[model samples]
Target: MQQDERQRKMKIMEVRMREIELSLSNVKLLLREKVAQLKEQLHKNGKADVLIGNLYDENDVLLEVLEKTKQRHIILEKKNFLLEEKISSLNKIMCDLTPPPSLPYHY
Candidate 1:
C-alpha cells in the first residue's frame, strides 16, 4: 500500500511541474513581444530627433540669409539718396549757366 501511495504522489508532482513550465513559457513570450515594441519605438524616436535637428539647421541658414539681404537693402538705400542729391545739384548748376531769353522792356 505504501508503494502504491508513493507512485500516486509522483504522478501528481509531474503534472504540477508541467503546468509551471507552460506558465513560464507564456511569460517568456509576452516579454519578448514587449521588448520588440520598445525597440521599435526607440528607432522611431531616433529618426524624429535627426529630422528635428536638420530643420533647426535649415532655419538657422535662412535667418543668416535674411540678415544679409536686409544689410544689402540698407546699403542700396544710402547710395540712392546720395545719387539723388548729386542729380539735384547738377540741375541747379545747369540752370545757372544757361542765359535767359532777351525781351523788350514795356512800361
Candidate 2:
C-alpha cells in the first residue's frame, strides 16, 4: 500500500511537470511569432515603427505622471478635510467667547 501510494504521487507530479513544459513551449512559440510579426512590420513601415516607439514611451511617461497626480490629489483631499475640521472647531470657540450685546436704556 505504501509503495502504491508513493507511485501514484510520483505519477501525478510527472504529469504536472509535463503540462508545465508544454505551456512553456507554447508561450515561447507565441513570443517568437509576435517578434517576427513586429520585425516584418518595422521593415514594411519604417516611419510608423519609429512613431510607435515614441508613442509607447510617451504613454509610459503619461501613466507615471497620472499616478503621481492621483497620489497628490489624495494628499490634498486629506489636508482639506483637516483644515475644514479645524475651521469648524475655531468657529465654535469664537462663538463661545463672544458676548451678546446689552439692550439700550429705556426712555
Residue-level lDDT of model 1, residues 1-107, one tens digit each, is 99999999999999999999999999999999999999999999999999999999999999999999999999999999999999999999999998887798899
Residue pairs clashing in model 1 are none
Q: Against the correct fold, how does model 1 do in TM-score? A: 0.61
What TM-score would candidate 2 get against the native?
0.56
Candidate 2 residue runs with Cα over 4 Å from true position: 1-44
Compare the candidates by TM-score and give the number of the best one: 1
- lDDT of model 1, residue 103: 92
Q: How accurate locally is residue 56 in candidate 2, as Cα lDDT from 0 to 100?
A: 100
What TM-score fits each model?
Answer: 0.61, 0.56
Error of model 2, residue 63, in angstroms: 0.7
| lDDT of candidate 1 at residue 2, scale 0 to 100 | 100
